[model samples]
Target: MQFYCSKAAAEALETTQKGKVKSWLEAAPVPEAAGPWAWQVHAIKLARQNVFIVMERETRFAMVFWGIKKGDGETLLKQFYERMVNLLLCMNQDVNWLNAADADVAIEQILQRNKRYCFVAGVDRSVQTHINEVARFCEGEVHEIGSLLMDADEAAGFDEAMNDTLRSVRGGDYFYPNAVFFCSWARQYAGASDELCLELEARFQRVRHERMAMRVAKHSDSSIPVYEQIMAVLQGKGLKP
Candidate 1:
């Protein structure tokens, strides 16, 4: 989906308080290394400073939501929604066509009781670590997932925790894969055919590893734990020292 802010709105962004600008862009609490906003930066690279636009590839639609700076969170939120609604109207789309974060509870309660929209949340390491806290609220089938961006050690820890959580799940099937490696040898463990569950775990680990590598390469100067973890994964994967 694509959206563009009016020229006035784009200009307003520059005059918006630095704090407000940070919040609007969902910038971190502390400054991150350079180019962290590469995607967003690329979007606004040559645009008229007064226009804010978002384009979605799937729908080939551009949405223009106006940004306003205000000290009152409630008022700001109201205005934000109104701007979103106005944008939807201009595009000749229903207000329900928009996607936002975690407002599922309220939106589902009022607008689409039929549950037309399904939101799948991507759980990161921190959220995965507190599985119980998440599972308490996330009631549904869980596909055992992991990140491959971590080193074998970190991945191993994550694997164990995932298995534990899988065991404790209220209702659902657990699926994963088995390691074909036998220590330093290439022999598959005897009598241990890889389960679907084990395969899922391995898949998650690989994806996590790749994601970590990308992150590390993208922010080479950052000293964040994610960067360190990515480096560790690269070393473990024999892709780096």
Candidate 2:
């Protein structure tokens, strides 16, 4: 994703050690030629595969940062700065009011987030299963939300649920409905009329729970199959396992 930050506004944010900023006001359009003064400030990455350009808005005389991601963050930022300086020098514009960009809270979050895949251990073998599982999860969430809209007793509750589901989907965070795992199997099964979709979701859930059970069993003593444990719980609840 490309993010834009104005030059004057960017300076107000605290800088971090992660990236450096530079000015590109006099950058050249080509290797030997320079670009307009409006195209001045640039934030370069020290690494490869990443680049950022900060352009000035002619009308407002404001600078904005535009970043490209494809390399390590540090390298990209450094290169971005170096390229801006070369471009400016070629264009014959004195570099002024240009410095490294500060790091911010959002940058910290980006660094702290879990970027590595949790299931990378068996990615080759489990890739297909993982894709199917994700599809089932998406379909199930949409189906569940649709059911809730159809069965809600209050108009307010239905509206709220619809809004919430839309927001979550737009934010790319939709997943399996957790309540279905604990609810009566019959109640959960009744939500979907499409037998195939329901079966796919259930199978996906079963395999997931089985994996979890195996992990748990590895550290403990449990002879029961994971499915059996789930079925027993359903039976005790007076629902078909």
Candidate 3:
């Protein structure tokens, strides 16, 4: 699927602090030489004084980095880049395995397989209008992913419950009642059955590999050990790694 940022987000990024602007200028020439998605950073330029634009050609996505002059643009770019990577990785399994040319072809195949389009928006009030307009233009559903956690007490309890369930299962203390309850819940939510769960379990490994590939691409030194161990396990299971 194509990715985009809200116009307001783009506008807000127009004039960042001086330090980041300077760094962008210095790094502009080698924009694709590094980063999480080295194949994606097509162009980085100072659109105007203190205003920088980052373009990702593969997805036709662009963002403006503006305001402030003190800190590096790492925080802003990291947040945006991670979200972009997540979307791309979720949409195409080959995102981590193939070369840029092959990866692009894989992404195209995925898009052809899934006809629906979706627009996701961050829950920032400043960009609501832009999000609405884009959603309208695409004639796609618009949704938010994270604001549900704003209910602090409910979120904390939910987290505790999930962790407790995982701990119990890991400790060989799986309770029949909880298992039945979760199975029923899954059936109601996604019509999951025993066979479907088994299928999903196998599919989970593939998804894990995709995520690991992203980590290896972005942080090879730290991610390689874990990746190697997981690959060995998958190989042991007679699965492709």
- The lDDT leader among the candidates is 3
How would you encode candidate 2's per-residue C-alpha lDDT over 162-225 as one tens digit per residue? Answer: 2122112223543333212212121222232355445544654565456546765675547776
List TM-scores for all candidates, in order. 0.19, 0.20, 0.23
132-223, model 1: which lDDT tens digit per residue?
Answer: 33232222212233211123334233332332222212233432111111110111111223464254345445654665577677867656
lDDT value, candidate 1, whole model: 0.29
Query: How much is 145 displaced in model 1, in angstroms?
Result: 54
Ranked by lDDT from best down, the candidates are 3, 2, 1
Maximum-TM-score candidate: 3
Instruction: List ranges where model 2 is wrong by over 4 Å.
Output: 1-193, 222-241
Model 1 TM-score is: 0.19
Q: What is the lDDT of candidate 2?
A: 0.31
Off by over 4 Å in 1: 1-23, 28-49, 65-80, 83-241
lDDT (Cα atoms) of all candidates against the true structure: 0.29, 0.31, 0.35
- Write the residue-wise lDDT of candidate 3 on 11-94 in tens digits: 433344654432222212232233222111211212222322333322123333333232334555554444333334432342
- Which candidate, 1 or 3, has the higher lDDT? 3
Worst 10 residues of 3 by lDDT: 36-45
Cα misplacement distance, residue 191 of candidate 3 (Å) = 3.7
